[model samples]
Target: MSADDTDFLAQRFEAHRGHLRAVAHRMLGSAAEAEDAVQEAWFRVSRSDTDRVDNLGGWLTTVVGRVCLDMLRSRKSRAEEPLDSTPHGAPPSPAHAAPADPEQDALLADSVGAALLVVLDTLTPAERLAFVLHDLFAVPYEEVAAVVDRTPAAARQLASRARRRVRGADVPEDDRVRRRRHREIVDAFLAAARNGDFEGLLDVLDPDVVVRSEAGVTTGAAAVARGASAFGSAALTARPTPVSRHALVDGAVGVAVLVDGRVERALRFAFVRDRIAVIDIVTDPERVARLDIAPV
Candidate 1:
């Protein structure tokens, strides 16, 4: 409240905002929710008496942990309610799946990816909070325990369970290997599709290859020809031109599209065993403005 107190809080926020956001995002899987949790934590910190707290960092972290846990618990309860209670013919689009261009996709893939977030969502709130804080952020068990209101041993157990679940799922290899394979697969797939070489594209595709679009479209290898046809048709209508053939999205290979020398689209590929396992295309027109992408 006082100038000195305000300055101290401001300094703390500057020092720890990134760390807080990382922990919250990993737990909740929503940047918007993570930001809200951080703001709520700050509000609680401001109302407290700082003089009584010896370790301000630890105190703030605990506040954030508690806030995130409370939010997760509320969400879980809603999920458990009867379906009729919550109108649900079809799920709404995920918030994170905004239409993205090449630049936006490139930037996002490095910091966060859809596959990784899906794995994180399998965890319970407590497990997510404990694991992200202790494993990802390297926060100690004792400190993390305080945030989740659990004993250190219990927090350690929660994190362990969460770690096992994540590790059990398949993860792409190191950045370098992932990128190399991604480029190889994307190039092969595109070339084959362009030439109407179904066998060529099939050869490069994994047996279970999947393609997803931000528009809620999904297709597998069995339907790849149809999917590719749709994409090709749209490409013609949109008059897409390649701005850059090779770019990295989170260290994975991506293709950039430009219209009038400005970035208009970005497509990222995921590879498995030297085959194209997944392809993500983002065509959100707004992404150009949000990412400040320059036209080729």
Candidate 2:
């Protein structure tokens, strides 16, 4: 291609850069890796002849999807830490990282919830690619199949499985309702404790409930209630006001305590009917970070 032709192609590629980056980010869950994937796609596209390609945008999207799929599969094979291994609250390194962009980060967090990223990490590369491209981006199954090397029907199935996992399809509709109710009970118990309402806390706790933590186990409703009151008191006196929010802990309703906008710990619960039968406190930083947490 002549200089003019090359410049024209570059402009066209630039137009699709943001979209391609979004696709790669959703697939890879890392800004750095997404940038690498988009750059690789540009390299391939610029080297190829596109004289007869009618839909340039569609063509570019598919190219990026294919690039992302390869990156995901390679990541799986390597069995290494994710490319975006910045710990939950650590600042990115200035020497090796792109300039900070809070606006873009917030947009991505809104577009793809942290919980969804956790679930996507559990999917196979093919399934993740099929779901993100076809379900999220409205790419046709024909194109999805081409990218994942599966039949259109197979590609459809891959996305279906991924969709099911993302939506917690393993849980029945009735069970889901019950889970929500459990969350409400948990929330109420926390509220009561925060306000030092012993009766309200007892109303949501099973008589034989067991509470386990790194400190030790506290059994019986009355005993647990007293402990919860003390816990709440501590939160009230802490330097920063603590916030309790419900989140999904290993696919079930649970509570997370946030201090200064970071998850300090989590409380996983087991229910006997409508009341909380067990409370397992997770304070280990690593374990807390791995929990499947999302807004309730």
How high is each candidate's TM-score? 0.48, 0.52
Candidate 1 per-residue C-alpha lDDT over 13-78 given as tens digits, one digit per residue, 9 for 90 to 100: 658766666566666766666666776766666667777778777777778889888888888667
The residue ranges of model 1 lying beyond 4 angstroms of the native Cα positions read 79-109, 172-296
TM-score (C-alpha) between model 2 and the true structure: 0.52
lDDT of 2 by residue, 1-296 (tens): 77677678877877887778778888888777777677677677767898899999899889988888887878767875444434344322222244535676555554555566888989999999988887566588899999989999998889878876887635446556776788789878878887888899999998989987777888999999987886775632233677777776544467778889988888878666578877878787886775556666
Candidate 2 residue runs with Cα over 4 Å from true position? 79-101, 169-296
Where is model 2 poorest over a 10-residue stretch in terms of lDDT? Answer: 87-96
Model 1 CA lDDT for position 93: 18
- lDDT, residue 236, candidate 2: 25
